[model samples]
Target: MMKVLLPVDGSEPSKNAILKGIEEGLLEGKEIHIITVVPGIVPVEGYILSPHVDDTNQQLAEETLTDAKALLADYPNVVAVTRKGDPGTEILHYASEIGADLIIMGHRGLGTFSKIFLGSVSSRVLNHSECSVYIVKS
Candidate 1:
């Protein structure tokens, strides 16, 4: 009855994490917590807003969660959710809130500059998360 957090960003690396877990027998029959964090709206008073981007972000988040949930359809104890904010922060917050014992995520995400210079969201979560983190390399 242990809890495991799976943060997916619709990336191959993220998908591999799930596959790795299953192959390693770590997530085969356990309850899983899946989350996809959409970048939150950053309003600029002087700039014009595109309604399309706002709606699209939320829609994308929902779709990502749906797809991720489907990946684990055989598991009955799965909880898929979506949040808005910094991906790393939200992932860790959700893990802490739910008291997840382990977190499985991708080594890198859609980030272009971050994963090159310092680290990606996965690295940030590893540094900040209170629980054990397993980062699946792409």
Candidate 2:
């Protein structure tokens, strides 16, 4: 069975990718791994530390993965996870670590401004991914 990695961020487009994957039977009998990556903010040495930074990020990541899991409820052999780091790099790393054959993700994540500010995650993943990458535009 093929291993498909679905990296999402609770966006409408990401939801569409999951629905499309299921409707297209791309997930049938395949191991589907749903992932959400939260980019963690690095603090400078002199900055005042917020004790809740990690907790907030962890919560957001969990919430994002939970929503993705709900969207993927109909798909069997599905596992969901969340990570904290650069989304593109994290997704690529996860794909390699899991030996995934395919990477499916939304073309846009969270907001357009973020994509504009930090180059598109999909574009970055496409450039660096070792395996086949499928970008679903919402």
Candidate 3:
């Protein structure tokens, strides 16, 4: 069973990647791992974040994974997880730890216009990951 890693963020581009992968039959009978990473934003030294902030993020992450899974309902061997850290690094780590054979993700993430010149998470993973990477353009 080959392991596949897909990093999602609730963005339309990310959702497009997921749908595109399915259309390409890339996830058939594979052990698919769908993951979403939430930024570990800590309040400044003098500031404090409301408890609901973290709670809301977690809830949203869960919902995103659940919806993604539902989209691939025909596929049985699938798992969803949430992580906290730098998205690119965390995705690479998760793929390595799980022995992923391929990394399928969106070409664009939730970044600003600066991403057009700088590298996006997909670019970073493509450059850094040891495993094969497939970029789905939105």
Clashing pairs in 2: none
Residue-level lDDT of model 1, residues 1-138, one tens digit each, is 889999988777788888888778888667899999999889999998898997998888888788888888878899988888999899989999999999988777777764463347888999999989987775
* Cα lDDT, model 1, residue 138: 58
* TM-score per candidate: 0.90, 0.85, 0.90
Question: Cα RMSD to native, each candidate?
Answer: 1.9, 2.4, 1.9
* lDDT values for all models: 0.85, 0.82, 0.86
Scored by lDDT, the top model is: 3
Q: Please, what are the lDDT tens digits per residue for candidate 3 over residues 1-138?
A: 999998998777778888998999999889999999987777689877788888888888888898889888899899898999888989999999999999988878778773473337888899999999888876
Q: Which regions of candidate 1 are displaced past 4 Å?
A: 44-46, 114-119
**Candidate 3 lDDT for residue 51:** 85
Of 1 and 2, which scores higher on TM-score? Answer: 1
Candidate 2 residue 13 Cα shift, in angstroms, is 1.9
lDDT of 3 at 70: 85
